[model samples]
Target: MALDEAMLELAAGGSTLLRFYGWEPWCLSLGRHQTAPNRLLGSSPDDLRPGVDAVRRPTGGRSVFHGPEITYALACPARAWGGPRAVLQAVHRALAEGLRAVGVPLDTVQSADAEAGFAAARISAASCFRDPAPGELTARGRKLVGSAQCRRRGGVLQHGSILLEDKQHLGDLAGRDIEPRGSAPAGVSGRGPAIGLNELLDPVPDPRLIVERLTDHVARAFGSPAAAATSASAGIATSAALTRLATGYERVHRSGAWLWRRERPLPAA
Candidate 1:
């Protein structure tokens, strides 16, 4: 979350950033404004472990269960990408191309109300695995990709998740009882209810391969060279910053006191 905020600020200052990350043991992440009261009832805070943990993103979007999913984060000046929608479409096209190269037929989503986009909750109307919208990837009208963005200082950080598996613990994540039916389309099954390269091809395609291909495609889209880096040096510096930010946000978010900060008016006494 701090990274996203920081990236947005940096992007506004004209710096570009992209990051890929993973979820361990699975976790459900909520959006900044999502209500957890309903979902938290009947659920113990301790119950979240191994595969269960809820953290709210500072971004405006719905909750997403992460595991066996490919997550990407990009922060850039809006001017560079033309605009939010155009950048989104470009990235989706690149991903579609990579999936197609591996025999996964892909298509971009078009909202029912194209003029006015769907709400974040509506994206969850069916399931992230089955819902689709502009710049999203889908198969037979089911959602295969979902993304959200935060604009800051004239720049934006658009981060999102790509399902490698479709139905894993999604129902539980949304507090629903629906079950995923049938086999998922290619390139993304098994990981959720869908299968991944690990199970689709004879010689499993390396995750590195997918990342490399997508990076190349993104480079072409942005007309810039892509480079890979590790955190050996920069990672440590960033980690310290993240730690401090997380501590501060946690106090504000986890403490009931903070929630009521704006609720009461000052006493004139």
Candidate 2:
């Protein structure tokens, strides 16, 4: 979360960043203004599993289980991307192309169809993959990627989780199967289902490889210069700035004041 904030800061300063990373011990991340699911707040053993931590993301969206997935964050000036919707469409299209290049055929959901499916699912907002929104990537009629965005400071930060494996534990966490048990929800159009690359690949590819391919495609979509693609050490000022931003965000994100703010409902929204 801190790193993503730093990326936003970079964008605010006219630098675009594309980052891919994962979590340790896994975590359930809630949206900035989302209400925490009751099951997660309960004390039952099944409700509060050991080793699983809960954190609120800076971006707004439903909660997402960050395990067995490759997460990506793209930060750039809103003007450079022509605004939020354009950024989303471009990234999803590039992602579809990249995954296809790697032999996993992918498709994207449309706005109206996704909204209808989301309404019909009637599932808790705690499970992001259960009902994907439009412009998210899907495969074989099931969602393969889930994403969200926040625009501010003349910049935009868009991030998402690309499933590498089926997270069965999500079922236990949400008190229901990760994917709905039966047929598609009524009024849902197109391939509105969810899936993972594990099922599509002959042998599951390494997470590192997936990141490399997707990064290349994302960079291309942004028209990022080749020289900008190389990994370089941050300058002293850059490191210091990132440390400051991360420290501030970490305090609120890890604090009861922020995590349980819904319990008291903050006026800030």
Candidate 3:
């Protein structure tokens, strides 16, 4: 959970941050640094089927994929950045604006409840791209972007995903009988078409394009195009902290006991 520890450091130090990242292969990422066993009862993630793997993200959100999509991480003081909602909207609003600049129209879904919680059990499908939350961008009623956040004592770190391509092997990944998602409007009923960068720009969209536009947009959103810093000199420079964070993740995230926390354990000694 690099994002989680990084948020703690940034909040403690009072720094604003942003990062663009991608997943290796096709992995399923869960929320709040949770593991697959915690989500899927009795499911074995050891073999990690050819098309499926899982990782626990520091942010709190439902499961999402690491394929043909763009992901981002940001950390900053809550006071420097707006409150949770404001900070989230700040990023999504900029993303919506940038996509619009490239000719892709989207709608922002605002939450009236604000307090209604998300249930993971109800959403076991592989398509996290279909869910919507307040300030999340959508096409008609279908989701195009999803985000989650974990606020620590100091600042907050938020991470998100934006669909860049359709789930190529949706059936094999999530399972058969899956509904359409991401740039596929065939069975989506009255939902607006999910557009991608290829549809907006003459050339196909790539990770680099997303990073460039998002970096600029985020800077502008903070009203300090110059205040935003993308250098690693800020926090990740500390070898000790880096070692601690890495160790913590390896011990908890990759460890069998932590990953399979849902399993019943023998009585304590």
Candidate 4:
């Protein structure tokens, strides 16, 4: 979350970045404007599932339980990617191309009205995985990818999660107090019925290989002559400037005050 925000500085300089990562010990991430359940927030490890915690993501979307999943973030100018919806389709199409390379029959949902679908999702769903807004990948008619975007300082950062396992993670929604999101209209979203890679393939492909294919496809999608991978922490942790900026964002990510609302701004790098 911290580094993704820090990369906005590089993005402002006209650099495009595609990052694939995962959560260690797993986590429940809330969208920029989303709310976390009171019981779940600040709960001890014993009070919740093992090896689980929570944080507010720099991007916008509903809460997602990230485990046995691959998370990707793309940061660049909105114009470079066309727009949020254009970026969404391009990234998802790149992901589909990678899945096809690995022999997974991928399906995509294209909403008759994407903007309308997402607008409805903002109020109707509590989980990004709950609905396939439009242009999301799917398997067996169930959602496979979920994403959202947030623009800061003329740079757009889009974050997405690709589920790799079928485990149901009712993380923040385990409490009985929260009401169900309920069903959407026949054509409406909010009932994605997500599936994982394992369910679509006899044996799931290696995570590194998935990352590589995704990188290549995305680079091609964005018209890169040659795509090269970088260490996740190459500049994020080593560069003093980025380190300081990331630290500030980290403070905001962990700050309880900013969890329910997006009052804190992303400190400039």
Candidate 5:
């Protein structure tokens, strides 16, 4: 979270950034404006499932379970991308191309009003993957990538999870069953359910390959030139600045006030 925020700061200073990462010890990250999951707030951390931690994201959307997935964050001036939605579409388009290059056929979808409504109604459930949003990526009609964005300080920060494997544990943690069902719930639109690379291919490609392809495609999409440091000494000054910025953001992300700021009374079950 802090690193993403730091990227936003970098964008504010006129530097575009693209990053790919994975979570360690697994985590359930809530959208910036989302209500904390009741199940999470009520249970003692020690009593919660092993390897799962909770944090609030800097972007908006729904909660995402981070495990067995590749996560990416892009930061740039909002005007550079024309706007947040445009940025999302452009990135998704590039991702679709990149994934196809790596042998995973993909498509993009924008959630309709009805689908958005369905997702809104279940926001309290804190399940991001189960409710595909507009401008997200899908494979075989199922959601394959989930993303969200926040625009401020003349810059935008967009981040998302690309599932590499099913996140059934997220369902267990939320106390909800998100297993794909044949029939849609009453009043709900039927979209291909959330899916992962494992479901689309015999052997999932290495996560690094996917990241490299995505980085190349995204750089091309933005028409940005890529540069590399010539030597360790050449990167020392820039690296130190990033380290300082990340340290400050990390402090905020680790604070109790920010993590539990949206706590609310659980609705009657």
Candidate 6:
């Protein structure tokens, strides 16, 4: 999360940084403004599950369990993408094309189709995968990619998840109704319907192929070039600006107080 934020802070004027990653021992991450969970459904969250950790995202969206999914984050200049809405759609559109290239049959959720149930679901669902927001990538009618966006300075940081071949088994999170989802390759917990690439293609295509396609398409669509920097220690992230930015974000993510919403503001420096 901190490194993704550092990328946002240091993104060059016209380029986008795409990051694909996973959690280290698995964790539950909350949206920036999401409250700490009172009661979590399905398996025990960090509160009940000893040793596992939880943290808050720097972006907005509902809570998401980090295991059982492939996550992507993009840090790009907002103006280049024409702001948040454009940022969301352009990326999803690009990703849809890329996924289709690999046989995923992905589609962008039309705003009109998404509006009807959005309000109720938005308030009631506790997981980001619970409903497809306008511009998210979906397959058949279930979300194939669930994303959320937040803008900072002149840049945009969007975070999303791609589910795997089986039902995420959300342990039936609270406050939602569940009907068994339709079809195979992907399933919903009490959360919502989402498809995984493995379900569509047995053994799931190598994630690298999917990411490679996503990189080429999004870079071209945004008129930007792509670069690879594997880690904060090994790449441009070592620069002073990113190191400083990462420090603050790292502090937030590491704080149990911040994670559970018991944080006290640091004294003015």
The C-alpha lDDT values of all candidates are: 0.54, 0.66, 0.55, 0.67, 0.66, 0.62
lDDT for position 92 in model 3 = 75
State model 6's lDDT: 0.62
Candidate 6 lDDT score at position 234: 46
| Candidate 1: tens digits of C-alpha lDDT, residues 211-247 | 6676666667766522222221233235454345434
Between candidates 5 and 6, which one is better according to lDDT?
5
For candidate 3, lDDT tens digit of each residue in 83-152?
A: 8667776777787876666556676557543224333324443445554655577765556677777677
lDDT of 2 by residue, 149-249 (tens): 77777878888888887563453335443322212234433222457787889887777677678878998899872122222233312456655766666
Runs in model 2 deviating more than 4 A are: 42-50, 108-126, 168-193, 225-238, 262-269
Considering every candidate listed, which one attains the maximal TM-score?
Answer: 4
- Model 1 / residue 109 / CA error / Å: 5.5
- What TM-score fits each model? 0.69, 0.77, 0.70, 0.81, 0.78, 0.77
- The residue ranges of model 5 lying beyond 4 angstroms of the native Cα positions read 41-51, 108-122, 168-174, 177-192, 225-238, 262-269
Every model's Cα RMSD, please? Answer: 7.0, 6.9, 6.5, 6.1, 8.0, 5.7
Any runs in candidate 4 off by more than 4 Å, and if so which?
Answer: 42-52, 111-115, 172-192, 225-231, 234-241, 260-262, 266-269
Q: Identify the runs in model 6 with alpha carbons over 4 angstroms from their true place.
A: 11-15, 39-49, 107-125, 175-192, 225-240, 262-269
Candidate number achieving the greatest lDDT relative to the actual structure: 4
lDDT of 6 by residue, 1-269 (tens): 77776667755344577767655655666777677764533363334333435667777667666655667777888887677667777877777787777788665457653323333345333567666776677777877787776676688887677776433444224543322221222343323476677656766787767767776787777765344433234444546666677777677667666666645324111
lDDT of 4 at 252: 74
